[model samples]
Target chain A: MGHIVEKVQEYLERIERSSINAYIHVDRERVLKEAENLEKNEKLKKRPLYGKVIAVKSNINVKGYLVSCASKTLENYISPYDATVIKRIKSQGGLIIGMTNMDEFACGSSGETSYYGPTKNPRAEDRIPGGSSSGSAAAVSAHLCDMALGSDTGGSIRNPASHCGVVGFKPSYGVVSRQGLCDLAMSFDQIGPLTGSARDALLLTNIIKGRDFSDSTTVDTPEFKVWDEEEMKNFKIGVIKEFMEVSDERIRERVERAIEVFRDLNWEVVELSYRYIDLALPTYYLINYVEFFSATRRYDGRRYGYPIEEVCGEEVLRRIMIGRHISKKEYSGKYYKRALQARRMMKREMLKLFKDVDAIVSPTVPKLPHKIGEKLTPMEMYAYDVLTVPANLCGMCAGVVRCGEINGIPVGLQIMGKPFEDEKVLNIMIGFEENF
Target chain B: MVDREKVEREAEEIVKRFSQILEKYTFEEAEEYYILEIKNVLREDEEPSVDPSFREEVLKIAPKTRDGYIVVEKSRWE
Candidate 1:
């Protein structure tokens, strides 16, 4: 345990931890205590993530540990039980370094509105790390831990991962149980990994994911075949036209270059249109508002102790208000139902689209990171999630790969596959990395 | 006059929705605070929107209207 603590401390200094503020708290005492046993007294457990040090997003419960959702309301509250993912990670020998910071209630696309303060991009501290999984993204970029776990509810995880120039994966919904997730649009939320490499990502996901009884929504992945060197010869890939059109010209160019790499690998690009993706954000926010209004009743100041209404930051408050207005009596189904129908329509369209392409590839975020603490015009920040949110809304397995650099900061290419075909999507990614 | 109770009910639903996005609040309290705040907004708001017809609409919904707006019984908060 002491050895792990020393190693974690060494990583802290090496990563220049002071600048990023990725973690809300690092539980050195628990981690080190566990590490001591693993080193001298503990027997080797046949765990894939054994001896690996990973961080958890503040949203996930860590059992008797503080799991602040980066809000002052949750600041003093400690989790009484482990979230399913946290339990799996610990059982598999992955050590929890600490809970990483995030946007209050995972409301914003950019990491700026965290009550604990925004986490800066380790690649470029001057810029905002895309969020609400801002701290998880920065932690890997800084190598503070091997990788971190983050929740993606409308692109929170992938947006940050892309801006930070690291790999982020959002498994098909229900693949990773939501048993312990601090519900953010529960239907849209999924626990996923943010790692330095696709290899590490696969290792962590395989451990934490599976059908758990605790999460009634979870189901098993079907017999998905992995693409071996031989099978890679004839698989087709699709590029959503609207998604490829970057809001920034340079990001568009970067994506084109990454596309060329696929061309070099003899992969065919299937041009397709997913116009419904354009409505993804509005629909998402609508559904989120309705669902969030329903979900938050558990925190009535009496049971949860803190009043989220008083302590939660502005972004959260805005969503609450927006959701409130949309949920009026006659308007009940007007916004929320329409959004769900849109989600259904998009998912149905993509189901057909995925039939033709082995995976869909696009730039994760259309732009790179913006300056830290910079007041972003709301629309501008919202654009960061444009490329990623559609997948969440559509219930697809999506991942981001660091493709190239823009002014020394890394940009990522997003690859999404059919629902429940997370393994298929990841295998293709791993195959691409083998070529690299 | 707009009943604060109606607004409170709406606010409860709003807080309930906000809780979904955040899940920070438990189900009961979120519902309570939400409803109460909405009632408060109704109570304090002389007018809710900037639309020109808002005053007219209030008068139409209310028991009476004088001039361009609802002619409600005066209250301490108002």
Candidate 2:
């Protein structure tokens, strides 16, 4: 226990010196007191995640901490209670280290949209850490925390994980309770884990997942099954053509090499295509606009820190305005309803494809993360999520693992499975990670 | 005293943006799509007990409070 406290202190020291801007808030005295309390408890060794330091994305509540969602709208707002996931982690002996930075209201693909500052990619300091779970991925990559919780509403977890060269898992929708998470898109969001390895991600996911009375969307999921070191032979992996075609040539090559690694292990690699895959990004963003607008109506300056429209960052404002416009009774059917139809079509297509293949694989992003302040249009930033949004659109479980590095920058290989097949996705990720 | 022309311009702009979004997904017009995944998970309608001090705790964080009530701007009608 003494050594664990010392290690945590050391990590805190490193965080103080770090320039990545990964954390929006850290309460040193409170963290040390919690660690000291754990040390005094003799039964600490019996608990899972004992002495593990877990960073939380700012959108997820940790009692008494700022759950700002990296926005000025909630800058001074303190969480009155812990999110269900935070409670689960703490109960399992995990220490809540700090709140990590993210895109304001989880609206951007790049980390630059954070009100705190952009979370620089630890792998490449100049490049943006892909977001909206930017700091969680960056902190794990820099070894500032053992694990972190991040919410994925259309690739928030996996995108940053891809850029930072760590493992991130977005469990099937409703697999993990979203009780205290600040919603991005309620229908698309799921709280997930990002860690240095798939095994750690799985361990954390198991602790946090299950039904919660506070979140009615949560379903009764089976107890998480640990994966045996099974051989990769005979597993059918589908290579999504749409993902490859949109990806940069270097990224595509790296992903192809990763697929070849699976092929070399005697697994069947099948090249497959979903015809309407290009429609995923537009559908995903449309849904995000509507849901985010609804979620933000609560921050009208009376209850929260400030009025959202008055203080939110540019990207956040853009989504809110668009969301309000689209949700108008006269225009709802034209944009919002049409997007929902496309979403259903995507889910149907994915379910049909899963019947033929055990899992789908692709490069996590279409292009490498650009320089931290690189000038990119909103549309260009949206394009970065082209390859990662389909999983969320279809309500499937997906995991991203570092596949290869191009010019010292990491590329992530995404593996996705049908709903409630989270364990299978993690297992496949574990197999690929070990082989790589 | 309705500004008919101004209202018409705003309406046209909204429709233009909506059309652009629809075109992005290759949808000429909105189509009815059933949400197949939703289930009505209704729980028993019973009021659960809450801690007496919960109100005090919540009020402590409100931006403006007076006499145990959250204060808000008065309505224009009022």
Candidate 3:
């Protein structure tokens, strides 16, 4: 274990400017010394993830470390305590390496608008690492960390996981505690694992997920059994035609090929549709605007920093303004209440779709990551998250697996299951990524 | 054709809601950014269906307007 930590330290130092702009801070000595401590603990008490090095998203509080959220607002700020997920991972003997960079304040989809600058795609340097969980995905992909913890609010984890060619899981909303996460949105935000493999993600999630006094939203959840590679080949999966038809041909083709692999393993494929999926974006944006406005009050610049508006990115300002507008008396619940109703419709559609299948399958992203400094109008960027938002609005657990490459860039296949059926999604993802 | 009533209402809503944010930015910078956004919204060429009261309410949010163009507090000083 000490040897591996030494290697990770060496790699962290060697990767100049980072192949992917992943880490916010790399305490090389701290991580290595912790590794040495674990190596010397002769009586290991069966911690689920013994000595595994984990990179955490900056939003989740880690004691004695800065919680920057890739924003200038909290750059010098240090967390006084650990988040529920962090405490659990620590209890399980996981070594915390450092904080990963993200889209500023967990805003934006392309990962370009972070205060720490953008994280590049490790697979293709010019391309973006999709975010706001950009650094966490890049860290695992670059072998900087074994696994990472990231927050997913409207596909923050899964989007980057798809773009960076890794496994990203967003647990059943409210099932995973959010006590320590510097939230993007109270209802939609969740902390989950980004890893090289589904197995690691599942192991990490199980360690952190459960009832916590800090977050009443989390239930006393049990770990679900994920099927082994051979067992999932026999599973039934549904492909949302809405997802396949919307993506670029190369991306859709890669997902199609992945589905074929599943079929060759004897899995059944059913074409499914719930047409109202178009409503997810406006609904997602509205819910996000209102909640994000509410979540950001602490950043009045006095607590975290003052006058953050000067250093805060445009996307952050946009949300703060939009959220502020939504809270006014006139628009009260017009956009928000309607969106919730739309969410209910989405949930109904998801429920009906999941009735005949064990898991729903599609490319986690419909397009490959675009190059950095390449300008995309904000709406075009928002369009990138179309595939994953429906899963979030309906409160389903979904996993992203690096399925194939498009023009040499990676595309992810998303496996989504009914609410709280994260284990089922994880099982299918393990089977899906065996080829990788 | 661009519906003046619809544009007027959207303009008002922008000023009413964001006047505070505008306080941080120059009134012209905010109004330029805000008014242009309101005008740029691709409105359908249909008869106004929004409430007349809402239309009046929206127009009231704007600080000034004349000669078919929404006016703003000048930024030449700041």
Cα error, residue A398 of model 3, in Å, equals 0.3
Candidate 2 regions with alpha-carbon error over 4 angstroms: A229-233, B1-21, B24-38, B42-57, B75-78
Model 3: per-residue Cα lDDT over A1-436, one tens digit each: 4665675676667544465768888776777777778767665447777778889988888876778888887777776668888878877878888998889888988778878788888888889989889999988898878899998988999999988888999998767889988888776788899999988888998988887755656666777667656655567888888888988998888888888877877878899986866676776777777788888876655433444556677777767777777778787545555555566656766789888999988888777788898977555777888888887777788889988887778888888888888887887777766753
Give per-residue lDDT, candidate 1, residue A159: 88
Model 1: per-residue Cα lDDT at residue B78: 20
TM values, all candidates: 0.82, 0.93, 0.82
Q: What would the per-residue lDDT of candidate 1 be over residues B1-78, giving only the tens digit for each residue?
A: 224444355445544543343322111211111100112111243644454643443343333456755444343452
Docking class of 3: incorrect
lDDT, each prediction? 0.74, 0.85, 0.76
* Model 3 misplacement above 4 A: A15-19, A43-45, A228-234, B1-78
lDDT of 2: 0.85
Tens digit of per-residue lDDT, candidate 2, span A263-316 = 877889888888876677678887888888999888888865898887777777
- Interface RMSD for each candidate model? 19.5, 6.3, 20.6
**What are the chain B TM-scores of all models?**
0.29, 0.44, 0.27
Output the chain A TM-score of model 3: 0.95
lDDT per residue for candidate 1 within A1-436, as digits (tens), equals 3666577667656555467889888766676677766555354456667778888889898865677788876776677667888888877777888889898888887788888888888888888888989999999998888889999988887888888988899998768889988887877899999998888788788888887767777776553444567867767889888887655788878877877777878879779888665565565667777778777655544434365766666666666666667778876555565566666666667778887888999888877787877766444666677788778777788988887888988888888988777987887777766664
Largest lDDT belongs to which candidate?
A: 2
Please identify model 1 stretches exceeding 4 Å from their true place: A1-6, A12-17, A41-43, A222-227, B1-78
